[model samples]
Every structure is written in C-alpha cells, then in structure tokens.
Target: MKEYIDLFNRLPNLIILEDEPLARYTGFRTGGPSTVLIPTEESSFVEAYRTIINNHIPFFVLGNGSNVLALDEGFDGVVLVTKRALNHISVDETTITSGSGISLSELCRVALNHDLTGLEFAYGIPGTIGGAVYMNAGAYGSEICNVLNKVVYLDENGNYREKNLSELDLSYRHSIFQAQKNWIILSASFSLEKGDHDTILGKMNELLNRRIEKQPLDYPSCGSTFKRPVGSYASKLIDECGLKGFSIGGAAVSEKHAGFVINKNKATTSDILELCHYVQHIVKDATGFDLELEIEFLK
Candidate 1:
C-alpha cells in the first residue's frame, strides 16, 4: 500500500490512524481491530480514493456498521469510516440534501422539523444516509427510493458523479451500490412534500414508539437478521419455525423479535455467527426456504 501511504500523506483533512478496534465504533459491539482507520471529510474523499486506487489496497467504507458482522480477527485493509464529519444537511422548499454521514434518526428529525411528510418511516431506523441509500432501507412500506431524487457518489475510478433515482435500481433493500462495491455514496437529495409540522412529528414519534414496542431495544443488535423473502416475512417464518429465544453462547434469537439476533450480554462475534447459522439451518430445515442474511458479515 505505498499508494495508501502517499494518499494519506497528501490528505490532511481526514483523520487517519492505525490499530483501531472496529467493534468499539460499530452498532453490533463486536469486531476486531483494523489496520488503518480513516475518518473522511467531503473535501478529502476524492484524495482518499486516490490513495486507495494508487496503492491498489482494498478498502471498506463503513457507516454506523449497523448491518454488518465483523469477525474477531478484524480487517487487514483500510477502513474509511464516516462518523464525526459529513454531518451537513440543507433544505429548500420540499427538497433535502444530506451528507452520507448523517444518521437516519437525525435525518427524520430534520424532515419533521421542516414539516416534511415523507421520512416518518425512517424515524427509528439505525445507520447513516449512505447505508440507507445502499440498502434502500424501508419500514412501513416506505423506502429511500421513494423520496430520493439523485445521488452524488464516487465511482470506481475515484471520480465523483451524480446519478438519478432511475439509475439506482432500488428495490427491496437493494441498490446499484449494493451489487457494485465500487460505488461509494457521498451525498443524496430527497424530495418530500409539505405537511403539517405537528402531524409529521406525531407520525414519526408513533413509528418510533412502534419500533420500541416490537423490537428488542434492550440489547445490541443490527436490527433485522434476515431479509424479507419474496411473498413472506422473515420474522414470521422464524417465529413459526419455533426458533425464537434460541441461543448460542452470549447471542440469542431475540425473544421479543425472532428476526433480530441479539447480544444478550458479553456476546462475541463467534456467538453471533453461531446463532445466525443455527437460525438459518433450522428455518431452512423447517420451511425449505433459505433465509438470506441481511447482515453483511466482514472480517
């Protein structure tokens, strides 16, 4: 990674460090250390990409890490995490432009503040804007694709480009970025319609309350464990398989929400992986439908 060294040397705005524990920075609370941890800024993203490209080093762009499972051994390459910086948002009429590092909860709050009616479904959703766009994250039948107008992202060649919603191919929690690892989301524009401020806030709060009531918020989890299979729901299928509250070490299929694999207490990455394997095996054996994992497992 001489290119990485060269890039790092030129990019001063991004905070680059070494031997950082990823678990301490993620929502799942389990992951090994990383070789290099770089917190990037909008101005430095291009240069950082240049470093990665020039060095020919594999890199990971992470945001909140809410939907990923990092192994105990950790990652050997560079980890470009969007956390502290990238927190800008602007609204004009019904259009909202957001940085990739902004959290979904915060984004919902922004929308509510502006009396926007489109983002209520994202009120309690974890992860950042980049992750949401990559997954087309949705709840209550609303997705990022519903409001997204265009996306400004870094393509494979380290050049930034803007893509319209039509090019994203957004479907059930899947986008062009999900299928193509080379695309790195930088910012997005969402178009919402005006609504009553109080009504929007109330709706957001209502959805948040619903999430709290149904999901296991007491434990550390990456929300849903499996994707909703076509024509069926993963939670209902797992619950029907009689695998709720199942355990493997410190990890357990949430008693409250079967679709959520929770870290009961002192859970290890190994424990989480084991429980996921068990859930998939049992659910497949019972229903003959392979449970596709929604969580990205990384090492």
Candidate 2:
C-alpha cells in the first residue's frame, strides 16, 4: 500500500488524501476514514484505476455519494472520488456528452441551458450520471435509458471502449455495470430533442419542487430506501405498516416520505442498516411484498 501510495502521489492529474473520512463524501455522513484518490483528468483516472487493478488494490468508485451507505469501519484501500475528477461536459447540436462524475442536477442544468427536452426527469436525482445510468434511474415515468445513446467505459481488462444503449442491458434499477463492478464508466453521450428553453426550465423547477415537498430533503438519506415493489409502492407499504417516523437509534423512517430512511439526528452506519432491515421485516411480514433496498450498503 505504501509503494502504491507513493506512486499515486507522483502521478499526473492525481491528488491523494490519506486517511480521509468517508463521512465527508457520503450523503449520510457516517463512515470512517480511508485513503482517497481524486483524478483531475481522464488519462490519470484510467491509469490509477489500471494500476489498482493490476496490483490487486481494493477500491471503490464513488460519484455523488447519494445512493450509498458506507460502513462505519470504512474501506481499507483507495476510495476513488470522481465528483471532481470526471466532471466534464460538452454539447454538439442536440447531443450531449458528460463525464460520469457530473451530478445529475448539473447534467440536467446543462441540458436545460441547451434547450434539451429529454433530461428533465433526472433534474433532481441526487446521484451522478454514471450512477444514474448504472442503475437505470427513473422518475415520473422517464428513465436514463430513454435518452442515453451510448457510454464510454473501462472494461474488465482496463481497456476503454464505447457501448451503445442496447449493449448495456439496462432494466429497472439494474445494468450490466452492476454485475461488472470493474467496468468503470468514463462518460456518456445522450441524444436529445430541442425544446423551448423556458419550457425545459419550468419542468426542471417543477420536479425539484416536488422533491422538496415530498422528500425529506432537510435530512441526510440515501434517497428512496426501497425499490418499488411489484404491483405496489414502497412508501405506501411502509406507511401502511405503521413504520413512518419509526426510529432505531439516530436513524428513522422519514415521516415526510415513508420511502426514505433518513439520518434524523446523528446516526451511525449500523443504525441505518438496522432500521432498513427492520422495515424489510415488517413490510414482508405484513404484506408479502419483500421490499428490496434501492441503495447499496457498502461495507
């Protein structure tokens, strides 16, 4: 680890932070510390990722950190932070290309500024374009799969290549990327339609307001705790089971929106996991719904 650490510090466009708190990066603000690597350019990012893979160094790629629950013990290896490293964007006519590090909100804003119509559904999603595309994230009947044209990613062999929408195998909170965690998303290109700038802005604002009104935006949460169960909504089931506002330590089911498991006060990672399992147990026992978490629990 020390040799690799030294090697990373000398790499171009790479910044290294030793013993950095994961809490500072995650939305939940709970995990412990680890060495973090931030790559400011695509080549440096690819090189760092390749070196870690070849050297068998454990690492996790992080984007906006909104859809993850990292353990309190934190990772022992490099935690690659892409929030700044991969935040690049460009537009050509009605097509847009963006680094996986750019936040969904930022991507949406870019689209709106260019009068693009198709990305409004993702305007307020908390994660980055990579995470959103990896999970096939959707809202208000629209999904990333709808507008995504192709993606550039580092394959298992550390070779970068382009993949089109159909080749990615996207479907409802799942993608080939989920199965192949080593497949690093570099950037994504989208095909969008031209629309009135005012109309796009209005739609983005409307969705953001809906999130504010219905979600516990004031609290720290991993967005929706559970995926929408077949033939039913997670929030409806949670509310029905009398679990709204149910607290376990500092973590609780959000009263504002039952779909969310929020850090109400100062919750630990353990507290959040416990509350999530409890909700699963109650929801399954009461309705046979077998609720599944939408967010990942990273340990």
Work out the TM-score per prediction. Answer: 0.95, 0.97
On lDDT, the leading prediction is: 2
lDDT of model 2 at residue 91?
99
Candidate 2 has a TM-score of 0.97
Candidate 1, lDDT over the whole model: 0.85
Error of 1 at 88 (Å): 1.7
Candidate 2 collision pairs: none
Candidate 1 lDDT, 49-80, residue by residue in tens: 66787677778888889988888888887877
- In model 1, the Cα lDDT at residue 100 comes to 90
lDDT of 2 by residue, 54-105 (tens): 8888889888888888889988888887777788899999999999999888
lDDT of 2 at 271: 96
Candidate 1: which pairs clash?
none
The lDDT for every candidate, in the order shown, is: 0.85, 0.90
Worst 10 residues of 2 by lDDT: 1-10
